[model samples]
Target: MPMKASGAADLTVVDRFDDGVGWIAYPDETMQRASHAVESDGQLWVIDPVDAEGVDDLFEEFAEVGGVVVLLDRHKRDAAAVANRHDVPVYVPEWMSGVEDDLDAPVKQMTDGVGDFAVDRLIDNPFWQEAVLFDGETLIVPEALGTVSYFCASGERVGIHPMLRALPPKKLRQYDTERLLVGHGEGLSEDVRQEVRGALSGARRKMIPLYLKNLRGALGI
Candidate 1:
């Protein structure tokens, strides 16, 4: 069974059985490709709501119990429709908009930088506040190679972010992770720093050849 985080129930990836490599069902998980769920402030929060009906089913069930939908960043793939349908307002990062629209029923514009989107907790680094929640436990996804992690009760955070450059000492101090929850990319784990190091190393190596390649042979010179 999926877990709950707050006064409400927390949904999680449970029972990935033979339904074509699918996880167990949330109340109506056909949408949001629903990944994880958590409880916060006496409300049930659902993350990454997919367009599928199963996701909707979960939302439908939760709506009756007062569940709040939060689309972290622009990841509002299927949250818009459901939010409108149930009259449940969806929360989004301020940097993004139109990401979730349910006929102007209600929407919370969120951002890590401005407005009510400001982070709900404190962090060692300023950038860490840029971290917002789609559904409380769910973190705002910045971008590919975007360093995001989980706010574990035991104080653990982890995620893979593309390392375009080395992080400052302050940012480095903020890195405390345990699992890489979700990403569009395939084959990545929660060991963020290590994964980023490897990706950065590869990205840097690719750039070297472009700067010093021989043009004569067009192969290797």
Candidate 2:
């Protein structure tokens, strides 16, 4: 699907903590693709960034742009453009495959992590290879979990990706995260770790129901 342009005025801030900020450049869409600017060691790491006019002003708090990170294989959203603008390498997790060839900007492969967050491989298959970054306090999940309506059913705070609902990434529950940031939608901050556990534990149980709900929405029933 084609995406629209978002100028400075079109941007809406979603998640803001002491060291990171998440914004939605396309707020009107269902996907509500979110981008983040996380500060670690005085360097700002832009994750799955979608370019917006004057968006650079949001990064002024940090001394310099450390890198642009692409956590999910398909979420190369504006990384090259953003990296080129800041003259930083677009950092791709070393374990993630089939992504480096698509990038135009300079590429730096991260073996362990970027900044204070440690990278963990969540999904690895021929079709999809995703990674999540976390420090004890903040969890940045590029996919496999989200807060959008499509991702959740009734009474769900966070949810597994519909495709992975049958076998959700249960290991995410191990993190004692205060804030849960995602690539697709607004994140969770209040009681986030509990919410993540709930989502994972209930994913399989709710799969069929959620699929029917999505089907109804798609059919406008």
Candidate 3:
């Protein structure tokens, strides 16, 4: 909930967590610790009291001084497990609560459209308030979600995470994206990044109509 020291060049490393929430750790690649950072709503959030073995190091590096927030871009992943552990509220779009059917992990939700809610202090005002970052701040996102496809039994449909891993250049020209964080899959690798970005971008556009249709029928709308 506070600020991290001024190590401005640190890039959170994106790693896969079995639980599905994206993990980004301090720049230290040597850390084989149970560490993870999540990009929720738009702010950077890290998990504390990390797995038993790496608890001390993980906690030391993760302590914040101010202006930190936890964002949960997808409710389906059930991220509250980590959010609750840190005693932080989860960020979400206003439209999301209308459709985030999962209840177990629900926490305080907010969006860029809100008139007042400490929104700016908590997250970036633009980018759907998506992919927020601050000096010495860290963010983790499912940068690959947009490209990866999965079958959902409940909705009987598939949807994308809206942001995918990709090169900063091509992604900007192709999407005119509001803003997003790199969560998983091949970070800083131009070739792998571009491929994943293109795939996810294409998939997200395709999944929109389908997701809406399925959600509408489910809600009787």
Candidate with more favorable, higher TM-score: 2 or 3: 2
lDDT of 1 at 60: 34
lDDT of each: 0.36, 0.88, 0.33
Question: What does candidate 2's lDDT look like per residue over 111-187, in tens digits?
Answer: 88888889898888998889999878889998899998889977998889999998888889788888899988999
Q: For candidate 2, which ten residues in a row score worst on lDDT? A: 1-10
TM-score of 2: 0.95
**Per-residue error at 149 for model 1, in Å?**
20
Q: Among all windows of ten consecutive residues in candidate 3, which has the lowest summed lDDT?
A: 147-156
Writing each residue's lDDT as its tens digit, candidate 3 over 174-196 gives 33222233432222223433443
How many residue pairs clash (N, CA or C atoms closer than 3 angstroms) in each of the candidate models, in the order given?
Answer: 35, 0, 12
TM-score of 3: 0.36
Candidate 3 Cα outliers beyond 4 Å, as residue runs: 1-44, 47-59, 65-75, 98-106, 113-186, 189-221
For candidate 1, write residues 1-221 as lDDT tens digits.
11211223233444122110112233332121334334344444444444443545543333242323443444555555656665666665454434445324476654442221224322223233223333222233333233222111111232223222234113322334333334232222356556544444444444333234323223435
Give the distance in Å from residue 162's predicted Cα in candidate 1 to where it truly belongs. Answer: 8.2
Query: Which scores greater on lDDT, model 1 or model 3?
Result: 1
